[model samples]
Target: MNEQHTVPQAGRRLIGLYPARYRELYGEDIAATFAEATEGLTGRALLRERLDLASHALRLRLRIASTDPAGRILAGAAPIALALGVGESLYDQAWYVEDVIRAVSRVATRPALAAGTLGAYAALVVPWIVALLCAAAGRWKPARRAAVLGLLAETAFWELILGHTWQMYGEFARIALLAALVLLAPADLVDTGRRGRWEVTGLAIGAGLPLAALAASDATVLGVFWQSVPALLPIWAFAVAAALLLAHLSARRPDLFRAAGIALGTVPWLLEQLPRRVPTVWAATAFVVLIGGAVALGGIIRLLRRAIDTEPAEPA
Candidate 1:
């Protein structure tokens, strides 16, 4: 095997890591480039090149590379969604803490139960809070790692403490979605423009409105707010959606990418909420309808924009 033939063969194998469409379009060019680049490379140099190629290919496959619009949108939305999730989870945790405190009141009678409740609360809440703080501060790598830890803690909490149940499935789905977004969305691609402002405003309104409502209520403790915690998911979703819609409508031109990002960000909440709020028989139907409606709305906006663009000029 001469160096010439070996180089192309190795290049071709590396190119195979990309998606089918990518491979079809750029495989030859990439292979040629790879061969030329690695002509005399060996040892650590060759290993580094291979690692770089593999990582780039994986990023493209995940659609989370810096150049991918999906990546930017997801990355921009991930932090916003993480913030909302953290707020909701914190509220939920307050309920858990209240329960723990009450359990502690009876610690003398049931010491093991009280200790277990406190430990469970800590395990479930700490990592998520850490992730949220890290995301808010723009330290996304740590945020992602913390989110993964939170997901693992959540899973253990569900399986060992809560026991496997329908509610557990819903909770797991929400946590898994959050973790996926955190892991998959490249932080460097987060939009720091108008979309960023919209995300910030959405996070504020989504998380704030609920707290305001809670504060307005005469209840002094979270126990009174427990029944409403499930409802908080949809409420936050609605607030964020409304903010994003307002941003889209206010823009000089519609941004389908922004709309798509909004939809993607909403999925976790939608999936988690519908199951909890809607009847079992109607949950799937509602999910489909809501998603279809969003797509249809985007299409309608596009059509309207096209019609305006194609309108004939009027004479004075």
Candidate 2:
């Protein structure tokens, strides 16, 4: 095939990956632009063009690109989700530290484990605090850098410092998903107007809740409260579900965008359940059922609202 023919062909293949509605509307123009952009380009330049086309198509299919409202909501929700996930991890780490302390009191010879646990906690916590501060102050570029560094530190802490034989594969997957969401979210959308303030507040609240729980328990001298840290995950998940249901029921028109954004935020917690040895299949099944039911419930509520709005009222 001629060079001219090959570029257009490659562009068409990439465009075909888009949703049918999207492809039908803009496919030809995108293909032509891709060809024009890649004309006379070769090696890395040509490869870069192709990759960009593919990435855009993938984003459109995912409905998480800036072009879609859903994308904007997801972008706005990403930082909040990141904060929640980090906070949950820190809460777990606090429990781990408590366990280590208890073990040391019993054995009096695990100084290394104690030191390693504290080191790992610091590695994860310090950078995440910086990220949260940067994000709150609207310094997104620095926030992104700090977030990435925090994740890397946590990964190293697990793989090198702790040297645990077993890995939490689900936790790793959740981390990767969080990183993608944070990196892919459009900063312009995430840091604009009232939405930005809400996002920052959500981040602070999401992150602060777990720490506050820890502090409350510690200060009150209540071992039961400390033991209840694990229960907070389920409580958070239930609260999100309740909020979605209430939003759907209470609104004249259900806000699917907000519901979806909330759902995306809870995904990290859902993912954390996946690697559990017991009830693994049940966890996966429950997640699918929960998502399916939410979508169906939203559709039903929308249809009902439309019907009510269209119905004629009786004359008195």
Candidate 3:
């Protein structure tokens, strides 16, 4: 009875990290969930649970804040102070997509637009194809599906980012994003347990190398594909790699990982755009990536809170 009445201190600390509006609304429930997830805790154990939760929240917040576009859209004297600084960051990033696209279009060379569009279309197809191929392996699962959603979100953001550049052998942000999504979502096929067992390995190999190649591409190599089929190679590779990473993370916590990965990816793109050598198109791309990431986080937090809130409360 004493234990039942006693609340976990560390767990409360973890809950404190949430947006106050969130804490005010659902703080007790989250605290309870933390306790449940970290059952059988003592002093150090409680501290670890609290630390993890706080760290996760802090990391995500900083990542979103660093985004240039997100920061701009979120910019204001009042918004930051309100909702403990999470709401402004949570605004729908898609709202700004049109603006970003238009800004990017101004600097796009005909060749760059053509290459990017081709890349975008190709990125669109890769995930569905991968999902179809994995159908036989039975990769379908709820966690995986969630992972895929995260991936698609990531891909769309990257496609927007890379689409702005005219480089030949550029990274397949879309493809990687697609593959990542596929891994997170229902597999194209599900072949019983064997499907996940063997096919998972194949999927990993299929996705990883290509994305690495595309991401690592530089001036000379990318220029070779400036007007040709080789440009498609990076696209294909990225789709596969995204699939692999998403699959792995889905089994873990795809939501948090996606937030981290997408936010971090935007930093580099933005930095590349800050200098003249980087190009104006890329700067526009960075703007969208950062803003988009913040929006994504907001959506996820809302969805999570809703889901958690739906459950009935337990007796104290």
Candidate 4:
């Protein structure tokens, strides 16, 4: 005698949570399993069978529909990109804060200017600091999303509320470049597993960036170091060659592309520091925009190429 099969209403409802592709493929099999397992069951046994069916069906759905490893890696990178962009802004604001404090300490300053500076720092810097804290706690994805939100908030504040200029575009481009770097860095280099070390390292760098800027700006410090250090052109060339060679061997092109972009971006700053060169503002801005665009574009191209490689081959 054949047994009549009937699916519990609860079981059917739970299975519907799965994707349409999953349902189409495995829905009948799951329902049958649930019916057989729950047969001759009363209160507790029937409840347990239903729960098991729900979990097993969900697991199967996930296993079948999961994204490829490359896609997963790229998705995991969202936080880092968000954090880097936010951190770059914070890095700039740290210096701005110090400058404002120094101004307050040194000479009588306009109250409105000081207030505005402090407000800008608060609006822009605090959220990035929070993002760093979140990352330190091993919350990568959420932290980055929050940081992006904060960035958008600040950008809106400057653009609509306070207003911005073309000169500000250079600063915006620098932050964009930082985001591009995080997005474009080789997946292996990200090290998302080590929360303690990564967090500490990131925080230390964030704290030190402003100090490094101050040191670079000081005439005495520059004079002392400028004479001792060789020009960057040779070092830059060697670094690029090394990056290219490593990328060729490892098939890891992201870092190589990023390094090239950074090298391009550094030209204007390097020229500004050179004693002989008086870099024009418009020229420097143009160079920065181009470098930022190049870096961002390179990242997009790499991502697209990876996507193409990962796509399933068509049947002959």
lDDT for each candidate structure = 0.65, 0.64, 0.40, 0.50
Q: Per-residue CA lDDT of candidate 2, range 132-219, in tens?
A: 6777777776777788888788667667756744446666666777777776665555653455545555645555565657554674
TM-score of each: 0.64, 0.58, 0.26, 0.42
Q: What are the runs in model 3 whose C-alpha is more than 4 Å off?
A: 1-5, 42-48, 55-267, 273-316
**Superposition error at 302 for model 2 (Å):** 4.1
Ranking the candidates on lDDT from highest down gives 1, 2, 4, 3
| Regions of model 1 farther than 4 Å from truth | 1-55, 103-115, 192-205, 208-232, 253-255, 273-316
Backbone clash tally for model 3? 32
What is candidate 4's lDDT per residue for 1-316, written digit by digit as tens?
Answer: 2122367677678777667887787778777776777768989998767765564455445442123333234333333344434435544664566866865664455776766666666677777777677666666544555565566656676577657776456445544543443333333334456743363345335434543464446433335653233332222222332333233223445445334433432332233223323333333444445444455555666777789889999999
Candidates 3 and 4, the one with greater TM-score: 4
TM-score of 4: 0.42
Per-residue error at 223 for model 4, in Å?
8.1
Clashing pairs in 2: none
- Of the candidates numbered 1 and 3, which has the greater TM-score value? 1
Query: Could you tell me the TM-score of candidate 2?
Result: 0.58
Per-residue lDDT of candidate 3, residues 1-316 (tens digit): 3232245664555566676665667666666677676887777876767766775555334433323333222221111111111111122222333444654675555656655644554444344334334333444443244334434644465556656454412333333433332332212222236633454345433433333343334323456642243323223322333343334333423444333343332232222222334343544543444345345545565667677879788889
Error of 1 at 9 (Å): 16
Report, for all candidates in order, the number of backbone clashes. 0, 0, 32, 0
Candidate 3: residue 71 Cα off by (Å): 15
